[model samples]
Every structure is written in C-alpha cells, then in structure tokens.
Target: MTVHLFLGPTLAAAEAAAVLDAVILPPAAHGDVYRAAQRGATVIGIVDGYFEVMPAVWHKEILWAMREGVHVLGSASMGALRAVELAPFGMEGVGAVFEAYQRAELADDDEVAVAHAPAAYGYRPLSVAMVNIRATLAAAEERGVIRPATRVAMLRIAKQLFYPDRSYPRLLSEASATGLDAGELSALKDFLPEGQIDQKRADALAMLRVIEARLSAGLAPKQVRYHFEATIFWDSLRQDAAPLAEPGEGSWMQSALLDEARLHPVAYPLARKGALTRLLSRALSDEHTPRPLDDETDAAILSFRRARGLLHAEAMEGWLRANGLGAEEFARLMESEAQVAAVQRWAAPHISSHVVDQLRLDDLYVRLWARAREKQRLLEEAGLADPDLAAAPLSREELLAWYAERRGEGAAPRDLSEAALQAGFRDEPMFVRALLREYHYVRLCEPRER
Candidate 1:
C-alpha cells in the first residue's frame, strides 16, 4: 500500500515522515500529482504545494487520478484550495483551512500562500500567510489583547501589502505609521510573539491525522462516479509530464538531449549560465507577474514575435505550423516566456551591480579596470570627457560598423533599446554613449589592439 505526500513549508518533511508511512515529495507542481498517480501511488496527501513560482497542480489531474482508483486528499495551503474545489468529486478534505474554503469564507489563494526559502533550508517560511495572521488577530481579540476595530484595521493593512512582503513586524509597523490606536497596536505586537497562530501548520497536521485514521481504517481505492475525458489538452499535458527515465530505472530521470548539450564544449557554459539566469528570473517573475498572468504572457508573446520577426499573422501561423504547435501549447510556452521578460525588465539596472564582482571572479577585473582608467585619462586630457561619435569625422554607418565589427555582433539593431537589454545595458542611450567612448578611444588613442 504505497502512499505519496506533497509537502513543503507548511510542515517539515521530517515531522510528516514520522507520522505518515508515505514517500514525502516536495511541493506539487503542474505534473507532479499526475506523475505520482502514474507511478502507482495508492493514496496521495497534499499539505503544501507551489502557489506561484511554477505551473500549479491541475484539477483535471486529480480527477483523473481518482477515476484511476488512487485516493487523493488535500488540506492546508494549496491542498485546502484544491479540496474545496474538488470536494464534490470525492476528494476528502481535513482541518479548518479546507473548511474555510469549502464554506466560501476564503477565495483568494494568497490567504494560505507564503514566501519560503528553498528545500535545502527545510522550506523555511520567509513571510506570513494571511490565514495565520487572521487567526492570530482573532486570538488576540478574544484574549482582550486588542479591540475588534484594531483587528479589522490590522488585517486591512496586512492585505494591502503584497503576499511575499507580508510579515508580523511589517504589519505592526504599517499600523504604527497609519496611527491606528497606538496602544492596541503595541498590545497586539506583544501578543503576537507567543500567541501567534500558525493556521497552515495546524491545518496540515489535522490532514495528516485524518490520513492516518483513514489508512488505519483500511482505505479502499477511490471509485469516482464522474467520467474523466482524456482530451487533446490532457494528452499533451501527459506527454510533457512524462519523465525521461533511463533503461532499467522506472522513475529516475535525466534528459538525453540535456546531457548532449552539457557535453558540448562551446555551448555548455553559455547554456548553463543562461539557464541559471532564466531560473532566477522565473522565480522572481512568478511573484510580481507584471500586472496579471494573462497580460504578462501576452507581453512575452509580443517580445518573442518581435525577436523572431514573427509579428505578422501569416508569418506567425507559418512558424506555428512548422513547429507543430497548437494554440494551447503556444499559450503555455508564452507563460514561461513572460517570466523571463518580467525578470529581465526589473533586474536590468540592479543586475549590473555585480558586474565588478563577476569580472573579479573571472580574473578579468584588472585588465578591464586598467583599460577603463587609461580611456578616462586619455579622454579627459583631450578635453572630451564625453566624446560624441556623431560629431567625430565618422558617419552613422561608419560608427555602427566599427562597433559591430569590434563586438563581433550581427547587423545593428533596429530597436536599440531591446538590444540594450539583451546586452545588459540600461537603455539604447547608455549603449550608444558607451560605443561613442570606445569608438573614439580606439580611433584616437590606439590604432587597434588585436
């Protein structure tokens, strides 16, 4: 009787492992639940799962699993949300969180959402979940630590902030700033350290106990009444979810294509570095989302089309056909592209802060610094700190040609601002100004250094 549990910051793996006889996995992403069911898991319990960073666990996957005779249960955090949604379909829910969702008292996903460190840190929570804060406030009110009005004001302030930025200290500070009953705020702050309620933890533990009780009572495989339709969308999701397992290993996976890329002498390093930035950007972008997920996805699609010269409908359709990509698949791809663009836009300026550190690490700092200092000295001595390439005896084409040739780049960009971002410059103006200096430095000071 094999069981699998999807858990994360809501409860420690060690604590869940001690109580339940199940394979404890990290937070459930889009394909995780489906993959577990395919692996012949008898029962699956979800305590916590990814809320924003990656594709979420799908409702259809859970329904399909139940139809396939796998008992699926959810409570606390993402589990609670899913349980309220899929309860009519036979998935059992436990604890106050699930009940709250079921009762329609909570609708927003952020109520249970929290920012947390990576798994290496035991998925330690970095921010407070709204449900916990609400519970804590209620407890404070009951104990006469704060008045009812204060609780309302405090919750409003907490809700005003982004989910990731939410914390007890920040909430109290905001209350203080807004001048909402100083004495009550002070009393609530004092009450919070000891009296703070971790509703997510409590709900998660209740779910584990329920799972234990059901198992002790001998759980029969779920016999769902609803017929699960395997649509083309479902088929595509299944294909994407399939693990790239090697021969004789039923579950362990690593892609052969990725291995080939890693083996490439020239491409490997560049690919690895790009992948690292993309991963970081995706994580950051997930939270910010740049207005809304749909809008972000559309914006990414626009950028992608611009890059590939696929802005025209005819050209886009042709490319889509060539790639054998349907509308659904294209939309999914754009979702990921959105994350990349969002990160790039926000980090363009701040990312350069590490330019010196990066150069030092690569052992190129001294050479670059010496060249920069020499350039500064020469330009200043010439009484031309900001050398204007246009004013120089050089045509527009000549300047672009020189810069392009020196940089080993392709044709000059039509939209220099976009190119600037790709090159890690703040904007086209900055890139153009940098080029002006370099062009003059090479032309006036040194003939050329090969």
Candidate 2:
C-alpha cells in the first residue's frame, strides 16, 4: 500500500532506509504534502517537537493526509514528536529518538543517545513512535482517522505529559541524568497548551477536515456548505471581537423578522414591500416601480430580518407614511377593507387552509402594530443616551461566557437556545468557548452557580 511520511531534516538519513515506495521531507522542499501524495509518494515527516511549535501548519498537513486517505509514518527526532500528535489523526508507525542524558544509553560523538538505547524518560526510545503505530492501526480498523480512539489516545498522551505522576516523574528524572534536560522535557507541554485540553487547534482543524471529507464523500452540499460558511463567519467574528456572549441564535436580524411576523403579519408584508421599494428607488429613482417580489427576494428579506432587527411596528409605520398612508388613513383602510379575507386568500397557497381559518388576521395586525409602536418608543427613549439598555458590542470572552451561561443555567433566550445556536453558529463553539475558558474575568456562568 502507498504511504506518506513526514520526516524531520535531522532524521533524513535514518528514515531513508524505510521500505516505503517513496519519501517526502519536511520544511516541505518543493510542492506541499498534498502535491507529494498526488505524485504517488508515501509522505514521511521528521522534525523536533512539531506538535508544540508548529501545530497549526502541522495539523493542516495531517488533515490533508487523512482527507486523502494517505498512509503516514515517522520516526526519530521530530518523528517522535509527530507520532504523539498523529495519534488523534489516526496515523501509525514505529520509530526512535535519542534518550535523555540521564537515561541508560551509551553516548555518541554528537552527545545524543545511541539509536537502540532506552529513552531516559523510562519509556523506550520508540514510546512516541509506538503511540503513532497504535493510532494508525486503530484508524485503519475503523476506516477513518480522528475517531474516538485517536481522541482518547491523544488525550491520554497529553495528560501523561502535562500531569505525570510520581513514577513518571522519577522515570523522567532518571532519563534526564543521561542527557535530556528540562528544556527537552518541557517540550512535552506542546501536547497541551495553556492548561486547556479541549480547545487544541489541532483538534479544531482535524474536526473541520473530517467534516469537509465527509462532505466531499457525498454528504448534502447545501447543508455542509451552509454549516462551513457559518463556522468560518463565527470564527472570524470571534477573532475580530473581544470575548463576549453571542446574541441569541437567530441573530438580531432574524429575531426581528420573527417578532414582526408574530406581531403584525399584514403590516410586515407592507413594511417589507416598502423597504424593498425604497432600496430600489435609491438605486434608480422615486418614479421607478420595483419588480414584483420573487422567492429570492423573500429569502433575502428573511435573512436580513434575522441578521438585523428589522420590520418593527415603528419602522412599518414610517414605511407606510412614506408610501402615502398617514396614521388616520391607515386606520381607515384597516377598518374599511376586507383585510381578513384578503390575507386568507393571499396565504392560501403558502399555508394550510386550517391555519388561515384559525388565524384572525385583522386582530393580529392591530396587536402587532401596537407592540411595534411600543418597541419603537423604547428604541427612541434609549437612543444615544441609555448606554446600559442599548445592545453593546461584546468581546469574544463575553460572548463565550454568555453562551456558557446560557448553556449551564438553561437561561438562553428563546431565540438563542441550543437548536438556534447550532443553526446560526454551527462549528464556532470551540473558538467561542476558548475565549470563555481563557478569561475567567468574563462571567459566563450564572451568578447563582458561581
């Protein structure tokens, strides 16, 4: 079977003897790992502590291999480092590295341990290599990399390195006596950064690659693409803003539309029509008659409503006034026209007959108008003055804490609950959660729980 190996610049000579059909070196010589795989070479990588130092780029490479179903192996130097990282990517292989100075290995002219010597850290020279081998085997069996086994193995190795017990410490100390120093041992921190295990960049990139692979393998494009876009947008926004709680799921725009629909269906349609007409008019002229609303237009309106708070009663009233209807004229028109019958006929094709019968269109319109007016008044009152009442821009941390608080206390606004969160935010929880987890100052948990 064809395989890809990633080798460190230092271990090129030793890895050259491997039985693979071809080899590719790291600090990528010419084309990237993807191009190497395309050329039918089994890619091998060797490096020192790649997991700790170059995780973003390294993880991307692993994801490319896993996505393309390319087999991978590494050893010695960075090979050992990569082996540990590859556990989560479902790569497998066997290799060795120099023992620490304190280990029981004979010293060489280079001051590194002999190839066959036991590692100073109480594990064999191939400990990291063995981890990769097992990971690969497990992935092969499962027919997918980044499986539960990979996650578990990666986590296990991370925990061992970061939270070693007495025996491990003693073993490491002995290994250090041979040659390994605090610097080398400390490199283990690459497995877990900043004490947070779940938010590793490798894991995030791996998950993204897995999802992309699944999508390419015949998953529905519409759903997959939508989710991908949403994830990217949320991540971008999180990066741009300081950590703060995210607004509820539908986004301000979406919630605004739903609120408008619930409060004033007839008024909503009119306001929507007026908004479109005005937008078009700005592009053309006041005398221009906009084209009839189409499905695309409806969808755009809905999307805009979700993204921004639009279609409130006050806004609708302003729209109506601009369209030549005064408050008194609007009231007269409602009172005189057969609004219920007109709405029922208009909604017949789109909604159930039973629903049309159940709904009192006239009453809904009146109630919605009143509520919209009230909201408009509130907005007016808060305008440029009521700082606390206004919706302030949140930092990334605040957004995450807000999300966590909602998650923990089950107090998320109706519009921003789990289902809505998934729909609106998609895969952005990690980035959002990172900010919350990193800054304890951002109070995401409910006060009572804290």
Candidate 3:
C-alpha cells in the first residue's frame, strides 16, 4: 500500500513526509500519475505541479490512474485546480482552495500559482499565491485589525497584481498607493508579519492529514464511475511516462527501430501492414473461441519455429535475442501457441498491400498504425534493447553532420535545413532535438548483445 505524493512550494518534502509517510516527488507533471500507478502505488496525492516551465499533468492520466484502482487525492496548488475539474470523475478534493475552485469562487488558475525555487533548492517559494493574500485579508477583517471596506480594497489590489508578485509587502505598498489611511496601513503592516494566512500551505497540510487518517484506517482503492477512454494524445503521454522496457532499454527504442524500417522502402510497407494487422487481431480477438494450452503445445511451437527457419538451437537463440526474449519467456509463448495462432490467423487478411494502401489513404490510420507497430516491435525487442549504450547528448552541429553522413561519409546534405527536412522533421531545430535525444538514448544501451 505504498503512497506517492507529488509536492513542491506549498510544503517542503520533509514537512510532507512528516505528516504522511509517502514517496515524495518534486511535482506532478504530464505522466506523474500514470507512472505512479505503474509503480503500484495504491494512493496518490498531488500537492503541486509544473505549468509555466513545462507541461502540467494531464487530466486523462488521472482518469487512467483512477480506472486502474489508484486512489488519487488533490488539494492546494495544482492539486486544488485539478480536483475541481475532476471531482465529478472521482478525484477526492481537500481543503478550502479546492472548495473555492469547486464553487467557482476562484476561477483563475493563478489564484494558487506562486514563484518557487528549483528542485535542487527544495522548491523554496519566492512569492505568495493570491489565495493566501485573499485569506490573509479576510482573516485581518475578522480579527478587527482592519475595516471590512479596507480589507476589500486590499483584496482588489492583491487580485490585480500577478500571483508571483502578490507578496505581503507589495500588497501593503499597493494598499497605501490606493489611499489606505495611515492608521489602517500601520495596523495591517503590524498584523501581517505574524497574522498573514498561508492558505496554500494550510490546505497542503490539511490534505496530508486527511491522507494520514485514511492510511491509518486502511482505505480502499478508489473506483471511478466514468470509463477512461484512451485517446491518441493520452496514449502518447502514457508511452512517454512508461518505465524503461528491459534493463538497458528506454521506451523509445521501438519507435527508433520503426524509424529505421521507415527509411527502407522494402520494410516500410511491411511494417505498416504488420502494425495494422496486429491492431485488427487485437480488436477482433474477443469474438474468437478460447484456445487453451494442452499437451501438444511444445510440438506445435517447435513446428512453428521450424517453419520460420529457426530450426537449429543457435538459430532459435538468435531469434530469441532479436525478439528480446529469454529462453524461459520463449517457452511461455510456446505454451500459448494456440492463442497466438488464432490471433495470427485473424490478422492474416489485413496483412495485404491493398488493405495497407486503404489504411494509408486515411492519414490518421497511417500514423496510428505506425505508432502501434513501433510499440509492438519494441515490446518484442525490449529484452535485447540496451538504452545505456546510447545515452550521450549530441550537439546540433554534430547531429546535422551525423545525419548527412549516416548513409556514407561523402553523402552529406546540401545544408543543415535540407538534411533536417529529409529526415522527416518539421524544421532544423526539431530535427536537432530529436537527434540529440536519439544519441543520448543509444548511449544508454548496454554494450553486450542479448
């Protein structure tokens, strides 16, 4: 029952860990929930997240996690924002910030946003969130430190300022600039040092306490009412968040291999057809009769291997390596040959040039099928793939030169831009980024053959 928490800024990692035992992560982003679910976390708490500098966590990823039976909890910072949007879908929301969002009292995302330090510095906050300022002003009015009208005036000023610039000093300065009386200003300033409310931090702490209580009582996995639909975009995010395949293999190895096949005319059509056929077989499999394994499994497997020219022990081993399988894994597949054969038979009709041509005519089908094929092939090659061997970063100039000379030393491109376009990139910069990523991936691969 491991619990994972993505937190930053609102509460320090040490403070969060003190409230609830959890694997504390920096902040939620893109695939954080998906990856946490993959890691077998039963509960997930999102406290903060990345937005301005990079992509924020996707809503579908949360839905996907809930579908997988992970109890997702949200409050404070990004959590509160996501909770408001997803509460109807089963994400549990905690604290005032979440309530405000749910009631549409705080419609803007910036109400909870704050400038914070880098992860290396423990994500120290540099500026206050608007929600905190609003809470502080409300508290001040309640405490009789300021008039209700003065509090309202101060709130308006705070709201007008950017979230990152909404510090106590700045808020007070703005209040003075807006004709706040000297007596009231003095009262507000004196009260602020110890009386200012940290709404985000309070909400974060409250959420953690809730988590702690639930854990102590042994809470069950959450069940959402809505079905999670895997959109292409969702699928892409999942792939990006997916754990490395086998040791020494990264998630992109299959795509890279497909890219390799795409460059060759003989393999391109075949890869496309194979990809489409595989998808078709998977979609239609539910209608087929059950094909349980029995005594004849081993013999049937041997015959199948022999038919594919894997007749000798060495040939069989080579096939296993290329397909990223261990002997034990190959044996398991052999035991389930009937099921495999059924799918293969069902897919046979779709593995033709005519069908592939029709699929290609539909651009979406072509792209999806290509991605599907890449995934399938990479899954097969995961055991043999070595990510560590290719983990070095390549410079833009180096990548351009490498692309130009990939075929042969003298076959360089007319220019960097030409080379990039020829390599299927939208532009030179995009191409350079891809090349660097690929170079790094390849460097991470293991040196020894599988």
Candidate 4:
C-alpha cells in the first residue's frame, strides 16, 4: 500500500512532503514508473519528469504500471501532459494544469516546460514556464497593474523564446522593441513579484493533497479493461529493470543458463529458434506479437503447467524460482506460446502447399512418401478409404484406451477436451476422430495370427 511520488522543480520536496506521506523520488524518465511498479508501489504520483537530454517517460510503461494494479496519478509539468493523454485509459489527472490540457486550452508542451538546474541544486528553476507567465500576466491585468494590450504583448514575447531561454529578465529586456506604454511595462515588471502565479507549482501541490486524501480514504488499485501486450521490448525492459534476476544462489544470470543450453548441441538449435521467434515477432514493429484473448492466455498457461506436472502452487513456485522467472515472466512465456499458436492456426490451411518441400529438406521424404503410398493402397483395398471416426462404431473410452495402449502411455486424462485443444485439434470430437483412425490403422498393420 505504499505510494511513490516523482517530484522535481514543479514542487519542492519539503512542500510535497508536508501534504503527502510518500516515498519521493527525482523527476521520472523512461522506465522509472516501471521500476517503481516492480518495487511494489501500490500508488504512483508523477508530478515532474524529464523530457529532454534524457528519454521521456513512456506512455506504454505508464499503461503497463496501471495494468499491474498500481493506481497511477499525474499532474503539473510532464505529469500533466501524460495524464491528459492517458486519461481515457484510467490514469488519474489532477489540478488546473491537467484541466487546461484536458480542455485543449493548452496545446504546446512548452507551456509547462522549464529549464532547471541539477538534482544537487534541488532542481532549481533556471527559466520561467510559459504557463506561469500566462497566469501571471492575466493576474497583473486583472489588478490594474497592466492594460489588456500589455498582457498580449508580454505573452507574445514569452512565446517567441525557446523554453530554455525564457525568463523574466529576457522578456523585459526586449519589451522596448514592442513600443508599448513604458509606464505600464515598468508596473507589470514590479507587479510580477506579487502578481506572478506559479501554476505548475500550485498544481503539483494540489496533486499531493489529492493523493493524501485518497490514501486516508482507502485507495484501490487501478482497473483496466485492456490487456497489456508483452512484446519483446517489454521483456527487455523487464529484464533490465529487475532487481538482479539471478538463477539460484549462484548469482547466475538467465543468459548464463542460455549459454549452458547452447553448449548442448541437441538443445541449442531448438532454443535458438525459440529465442528467434521472440525476436522476429518484435521485428515486425507494426504488428507486435498480438496478445491473445484473456481466456486464451489463461488456458495456455494452464496447459503449459499441466504438461510440466506443475499444476500445484508450490510446484509452480519452485519451477519459476529454479528458472529465475517471476509470475510476470511466466505469463510472458504463455503470451508467446499463445501468439505462436494463433499464427499457426491462421496458417494451418496453407501448410500442405509446402509440406513435401519441408519433408524433403529434412530428408524424411522417401520414407514418408513410401508409407503414405502403401497406406493408401491398403486402405482402398480394405474399403476404408475415407475413414470416418463418427461411424467407427467404437465408444470414446474404447478408442482412447486403444490409442493409449498402442502408444505405451497411461490412462487418458479425464479432461480429454482440453488435451484435444492442446494437441491442436478443433475440439474433442476431432481429436477422437484422429485417435480412431490411428487405432484401426495400427491394428490392421499387426501381423495376422492363427
């Protein structure tokens, strides 16, 4: 139930701390929110974030955090920008800055962008944010400190400068060029101390108060309707941001495990292809490996654990720990499986077009071709050419038992329907049909006795 807040020049640490009991951190950048979410922050408040000279906080990561059940809220500066864009997706936006952005009154990001000093210097403001300038000028005019035309001239001057070069001194230094009322200009300058409104700061503080109140009232995790797609990029980020994902007590990384696998000739190529599928899917940038429907992912996960005899919670935990994988990583593996299955299902009909070519390349053409020819001849002679399982006149259990016996396996599972789907059949009926064919074919091949 801890809350993590990213704060910077928008609001000083002391001011934010007074209103909210939060683990305050520096302004956010790419991956910061993700790291916070992974660190178990139930609530995250973003006030200021770096956008230049460093990668900006990503929308995808923020969306990912919310999906992970962290209540992510934003306001002021970069937070306002992100909150406005992500509002429809359940990111809570607070304060006047958020409201202005939501209403479309503020369009350019520079309206809140400011040049600030380093963290050691408390992220001291080196330039004025345009939003503050606008707020200040309007306030000045309201109090008769300046005329209406003076406000317009000042706003235009401020807007013309780049964000880093914007400051009160620079704005006033160029005021003589506009040929406006000298008296009004001087009064506006004097009034800026009292009349200037720091909108970004105000909004940041307001957001802190909102978080405090929500915490007192018992906050809930953010809920999302959309499923988060775990592309390879996401996997990379997760690995990079993890708290040193080690294999056992050996301090071994996953790559070390992969290297060990690569040393084994038989496992290398298969492992390589599995890794390659993940990479190839990512390469198709426009079509990120699509996330399967929730039910599909859940079913795939269940099937995977069942196949590995890891259905129990304790067994599953042990397996994940042995592999240096967490719950999220396991789910990601299931996602990849689902994606591959989905693609294979779509391409199933076109598979026969190149089946022989593949078989030939693998040096299985001669034996397979011969077996197919003989089987067809024998089936035609026996009048079993279009063998249909529905009319096979055998019970489901009899067919399953007969097939399992021939395969030298134990009794068939109780949930044969699930097993069917896992084996790529459309349903239990189709699986039964295939089993019946294999059963009769095997018996026919048995040498006639006595």
**lDDT string, candidate 4, 1-450, tens digits:** 798999887888888888888899988877889999988899999998876545678899999999989999999888999999999899989988899999999899889887554344455566789999988888988999888988898899999986756778778877766787889888888987777899989998888888888888988778899888999988887776666545464546667877888899879998787778666544442264366876566556655665676543335545766776766666677767767666555544556657669789999999988977877777777777677766776877788877777768776554485677556676787787667666666667887632
Q: Give the best candidate by lDDT.
A: 1
Q: What is the C-alpha RMSD of each candidate to the true structure, in Å?
A: 14.7, 25.3, 24.5, 24.1
Tell me each candidate's TM-score: 0.57, 0.21, 0.54, 0.54
Candidate 3: lDDT over CA atoms? 0.73
lDDT for every model? 0.79, 0.36, 0.73, 0.77
Candidates sorted by TM-score, descending order? 1, 3, 4, 2
lDDT-wise, the better of 3 and 4 is 4
Candidate 2 per-residue C-alpha lDDT over 88-190 given as tens digits, one digit per residue, 9 for 90 to 100 = 5555333223222113231321221111111111111211222232333344335432345434544344334311111223334544554444553444333
In lDDT terms, how accurate is model 1?
0.79
Against the true structure, candidate 3 reaches a TM-score of: 0.54
The residue ranges of model 2 lying beyond 4 angstroms of the native Cα positions read: 1-4, 14-20, 28-31, 42-56, 96-450
**Where is model 1 more than 4 Å wrong at Cα?**
245-450
Q: lDDT tens digits, residues 63-96, model 1?
A: 9999999998898888888888899999888888
Q: Report the lDDT tens digits of candidate 3 across residue range 1-450.
A: 899999887999989878788899878877888999999899999989877445789899899899988999899989998988898899999999999988888898888877654444465676788888889889989999999899888888888985645678878887887789879889989998899899888999999898888889988878778877778888789779876565345669878987899899899998787667555555555677355344334334445543465433335444666787765566556545545455554444555566567677876676867765654455346532323223434444566567556656653342354344334455666666565544443443435334
For residue 24, model 3's alpha carbon misses the true position, in angstroms, by 0.4
Candidate 1 worst ten-residue window by lDDT: 245-254
Clashes of each: 0, 52, 20, 0
Please give the distance, in angstroms, between residue 440's alpha carbon in candidate 1 and its true position after superposition.
34
- If ranked by lDDT, best first, what sequence of candidates would result? 1, 4, 3, 2
Off by over 4 Å in 4: 243-450
RMSD of 3: 24.5
